[model samples]
Target: MVTEVRGFTDPQKEEYFRKRFRDEEQASRIISHIKKARSLHIMCHIPVFCWITATVLEDVLETREGGQLPQTLTEMYIHFLVVQAKVKKVKYDGGAETDPHWSPESRKMIKSLGKLAFDQLQKGNLIFYESDLTECGIDIRAASVYSGVFTQIFKEERGLYQDKVFCFIHLSVQEFLAALHVHLTFINSGLNLLEEQQTSSQTEEHFYQSAVNKALQSPNGHLDLFLRFLLGFSLQTNQTLLRGLLTQTGSSSLTNQETVQYIKMELSENLSAEKSINLIHCLNELNDRSLVEEIQQHRTSGSLSTGKLSPAQCSALVFILLSSEEDLDEFDFKKYSASEEALLRMLPVVKASNKALLSSCNVSEEGCEKLLSAVSSQSCSLRELDLSTNSLKASAVKLLSAAVESPHAKLNVLRLNICELSEGNCEALSSVLSSQSSSLTELDLSIRKLQDSGVKRLSAGLQRLNCKLNTLRLSGCNLSERSCEALCSVLSSQCSSLRELDLSNSDLQDSGVKLLSAGLKSSQCAVETLSLSGCLITEEGCTSLASALSSNPSHLRELDLSYNHPGDSGMKLLSAGLKEPGWRLDTLRSRMFPEGPGGSSVASLLFAAGPPPVCCDLHRPSPTLLISAVSAPWGLVP
Candidate 1:
């Protein structure tokens, strides 16, 4: 039913080449040149990779008569780096006193900048102050005037307090520099060892141990991408490019082998899979097809189990599996063990997924806390979450409230039915609903034993000017007249967005119904559908509702008062309202309305062009009337 393009096809590829290379002849020739490398051609499927490929190939064709095209991602990036450096050098030579070639001065400056990038990156700082430049032995004024390699990668911007701030043009560029700093550190250590007459293997082993230890010590995983880039740089083809631009002393092959061996050892030691997945990506960069294939085989065989994995590892396996699938509809956690570790692992997948269904998944307060942390981190992609029928109590609900208030949270639909929420939990939930950053639009708090006080707190949040909620379900929450008063305030507020409200199977009596009628009569009320089924309403409530319905431009469209004893008098009051010229209500439901001498008159007024009323059996309970004005002249009973 659907066509897939493994790589850019025909006109798309041709158009891409034409746009990237302005010269038609050069574009055709470059395309022909890269066609010899199948791996590079396949990578061109991604638009960014295609741009990098075109940039590298164009440089090679222009600068050298018969330069070989880069075949791998690492090789292409390395070539692109060289091209960028050369371009900067050319521009600098025309306007500055310094030599443009890879001289000792330029190499020293590069080393200083790399150190600065690495230090700042480790601290999770992407933007740097002027003091950061001074600490790195960089003269900002001079660098800005000369427009050298520093200016090419690092850009300057005006700051709020300080006059100037600097950051890498892209995070990837900063990552590359951080990795380069590590490689240079290893090279300097090797050079010092050689002066002491130590063997090359010993120096490499030390470097490998040092790099791996440093990477493993970062609990926040800040060094993971840097280590990956460092491994990529260890490749011979990539190192060759670096050698031409920076000073180097020893062979990188030993370092590469040792690094790979250290990673394998770590993986064999049962390290967390989620934390070690980046190592897999590093191996892919090294073109280690055999190891990648082995990992793939393990994944396909389902050899990994929850018992063998840490929460982090479970997260990694789920990510790998989801990436391989074409469509990820749902990740059922029911198949896994009900351990806390298993649930923790599922959190990452839940954060990354669009919709998650965790009904009866045995999640506890600890799991809820973990999921909340993920959501608050601003990295989670979850839009809908269903935690119905869980054992979560008020404490867990409090923990979840922090996530709901997060500005970065994307959740729009949340179901927390029967989660043992109480009055205390309602306070926390109220803060979430009232938050300006909240994205919640549909919420279900059904059958949670939220009594009158709980609904009162929830009503305060619903009345907030910033609340965006449109549909609310509070069935069987033990509400009363006091709760109805608070809800009326929400419905009467000009800023309220409420469209549908369900208070079905509650304890709201005739007084509560009269109070709600005031809200329905308000000019600001936008509610279109209302359900007060089994709420113990009587003729007095129906009279109040009839008065509200007679108001001009009422928004009420569907009303359900089913399973209640509205009586003949109540039916007559409702019938009078139905005959109002301004009344727009189209559907109404009620049960057990007593038939009397005036019943026919009430029925004729309610359904003007309908047939005679059906008789109700005394032994059998009459079905509730569900009036649909557009479809039939009279109410339909089923």
Candidate 2:
């Protein structure tokens, strides 16, 4: 059987908690104060959160006369951390007076635990084993003595082999410990060696500059939240609480000043939007209200023009503006200026954004090279890219193909339509399509000059076992019968993953259709949609298509033979295939011939089998004709 526990507001539960405090009045005051903080009050609904709140509030009440209490999540955690430290130190000293910060054993345990946490966090592992603790110089026996600190933030579990496994209670707790490790390591090092070599102010400056550089160098944003916590811990109030718990020195004015300058310099040098946004968060934690306001003002003042700002500067400006808004996904570059600077600024945005649109941006080979370089970075997050209507050539295509092949790239949709591609471009693109790491699923190369040789190269890629391209658009690329033959081989191959093929408005004729039909008849062909619009196919080609359509368990669902002269004889053969029990073709479209016996007879035969379960469009007289079998069926009659 299962039982449900009542919430904090339950009278019996409230009475029980009130007794845990010194008096009922103290409990009431603490509860009243927490209720004033809207966010904190909601968190109190969790029993663990309520317990932490009560503990911190009780300490604040006992320590001084009307002292300021923790109001935010970070402040509350810091207070709880200090309380745990004091309790642990008292137990370790066995009733003797001792400073926790100065205790050798306490310092050793903190350092060891912090190092273990930092290393595991980098590996993206939250759970640890007995071996991991031993490797970090942490004895299992000592870990039990520090159970109060560890148990508050980490949960210990028994493994199947009777060994111990440990994980943080929350991810934020791990981040906090990692930040504390960096801070104490630097400050402790400075006190030991730098103080003898230079003044205390100089040592503090060195510590701040070193820490800032270390945090900024991490491109993956792994150190983001940790850096923010480090800055927050630099506050005087937080430092006071940590004085005897972790550190002996107060917060340094020099460290704060140096940190601000170092961060600004790093922001100006790097063009990553993710890194810049993290730096801003750290600045907020430092409580430098003026610097944050100045950066925001600079972005909104419109002084940072595409032509005037450098790439790094433009990236910083754009990131600052975008982070101020709530829904970043809605931000578009529709009206953005088509300049090198603008494209460069978008590089960082593309690396962090899920969708990127740079259509009609007048991008050239140089811009393509830079953009590809950004996409191939270790921190790239782009999944879709649109460079349509650009002027990319073979060199740009090669660069882009290399980027797509990078293991770090996550691009799934790529559109380079009307980009002036050539046979050489196709060769480069084919290499990307064949790469095992390539993530491309949709490719558009329409309206460019990719003749027989280009299509042949792309077909070679399609036949590769590793190629996973599902949708391909190669319309109006001057392809011939030879190109169709190459694509036919891809469809006939058992390893092919191609699903949709569009060869519309090309130079292909009846011979090309006949060649494609041979592959379509193969059981290995998985294509579902085939568009051969305006390929000059005649009745002879339709006979071959009919044979393929009647093959056992056909995969074709939609066929377009429109804008071609596939006369009455062609329709009769296609109608016969539609009547076959094994045929899966559901939609067929063909252009209307002149008003003769051929046109009427073909139309009647299409519906002769009691209006077959397929939608057929035979355009006649008007170009915009609608003969509906399904809902909202409209067709173009050319």
Task: Assess every candidate by TM-score.
Answer: 0.68, 0.63
Return the lDDT, model 2, position 435. 96
Count residue pairs with overlapping backbones in model 2.
Answer: 0
lDDT by residue (tens digit), candidate 1, 1-638: 22333446435666898898898888887776555443455446566567767777887887776777675556776677666666666665453423445656566666776877888887789988778878877778844642335564667778897577788766666777777876776676543211234444455666555656677777877777676677677777777777756566454676667667777667555344345565656655665645645445766676553445543345445545444423344655654445656666556577667777777877778778877787766656778888888988778988888888887788888899877888998899889888988899989998778988999999889988889999999987878888899999988998889999999777687899889889988989999888887677778888888888877346877777755557777765665555555766766665433332334423223223433343222111223323321322344332
Against the true structure, candidate 1 reaches a TM-score of 0.68
Cα misplacement distance, residue 91 of candidate 1 (Å): 6.5
Highest TM-score among the candidates is held by which one?
Answer: 1
lDDT of each: 0.69, 0.69
Backbone atom clashes (below 3 Å) for every candidate: 1, 0
